[model samples]
Target: AQSVTQLDSQVPVFEEAPVELRCNYSSSVSVYLFWYVQYPNQGLQLLLKYLSGSTLVESINGFEAEFNKSQTSFHLRKPSVHISDTAEYFCAVKQSGGSYIPTFGRGTSLIVHP
Candidate 1:
């Protein structure tokens, strides 16, 4: 079994500033993770994921996440955040070949200020 934890429930940041949403997981087996972003009044969207390739993965919108096996973390980072980036971020984990469903975190709300 696997579980995901998002350290911060809410992160307030100014526009164009660097931001990071910390995520950690616990599992006895190898697993893959995903970062999802949910904008207001919208469904959750896939921001980035770390499966089997390089430890680091990036999204088209400039967000990136690094899967650290030692730390069991997959923190999401953005060099410069925008107002549009304000949303709820969720971290999910699924054990390799375990289940089709993934365990999800409580979610972290990113509020970008101008």
Candidate 2:
């Protein structure tokens, strides 16, 4: 089945601490990669994407991730995070030659302490 799996459902860390959210996907064909962030009571925003190029990609913010074709994984990371970074992150994949709608992981919730 086309799906994405996020290893950690929730991560709690102190303010300014670093964090990483693991993501893995299984697809039959090539796929587009994306990481989206959603703050409380808001819509999802595109954090980064790995369309076609070097496996590594970064967001406008400080988040970054690498797309590994061999392992079929894309893990997100951020160093020295702020409390404002607390939010839910989702990993998604859109299959090539298929609908544009992406299949997303359950989601990883980041809790930043003060």
Candidate 3:
């Protein structure tokens, strides 16, 4: 089994400011971690994932997440945030080849202020 934790429930930042939403995970077995973004009144969209190969993964929209094995963390970072970036971000984890269903953490709400 795998457990995911999102450090902050809410994050406030001004437009174009650098921001980071932390995520940590613990599991007995190898796991896959992902970051999802949910805009208001919309479904979750894949932001970035750390499945294999490089520890770092980036999204097309300037968001990046790095998978750190030693720290057991996969923190998401954005150098410059925009107003449209305000949304709910969720961290999810699932045991590799164990279960297709993933366990998600309580989402972190990113509030981009003007």
Candidate 4:
């Protein structure tokens, strides 16, 4: 089955702090990487993706991730975080045929303390 695993279930940080979300995947074939962020009860928004070119990808919102083929991982990072960054982050992967829907991880909740 198509699957993605998020190592951390939750991450807590202070305002203006830094945060990272770990992600890993397993697939028989090639795949695309994606990071989506869910704010509170809201739906997810695409943070970044690694489709074809470079292994590195970044979102407009100051988050970035690197696709590592050897490790089969795509981990997200932010030098500093804000309270507004508090939300649920999900790591997803899609297959090459475009026949596979994105498989999301269990999600990691980021809590920002004031």
TM-score on alpha carbons, each prediction: 0.97, 0.94, 0.97, 0.94
Task: Return whichever of 3 and 4 wins on TM-score.
Answer: 3
Comparison by lDDT, 3 against 4, better one:
3
Q: Could you tell me which 10 consecutive residues in candidate 3 have the lowest summed lDDT?
A: 94-103
TM-score between candidate 1 and the true structure: 0.97
lDDT of 1: 0.95
User: Compared with the true structure, what per-residue lDDT tens digits does model 1 show for residues 34-103?
Assistant: 9999999999999998889899999999999999999999999999999999999999999886456799
**Residue lDDT tens for model 4, 79-111:** 888888999999999897576788999999989
Residue 92 C-alpha lDDT in model 1: 97
* TM-score result, candidate 2: 0.94
lDDT of 2 at 28: 91
Model 1 — which ten-residue stretch has the worst lDDT? 94-103
Superior by lDDT: candidate 1 or candidate 4: 1
lDDT of 3 by residue, 15-108 (tens): 9999999999999989999999999999999888888999999999999999999999999999999999999999999887654899999999
> What CA RMSD would you report for each candidate?
0.9, 1.2, 0.9, 1.1
Candidate 2 stretches greater than 4 Å from native: 97-99
Residue pairs with backbone overlap in model 4: 17-81
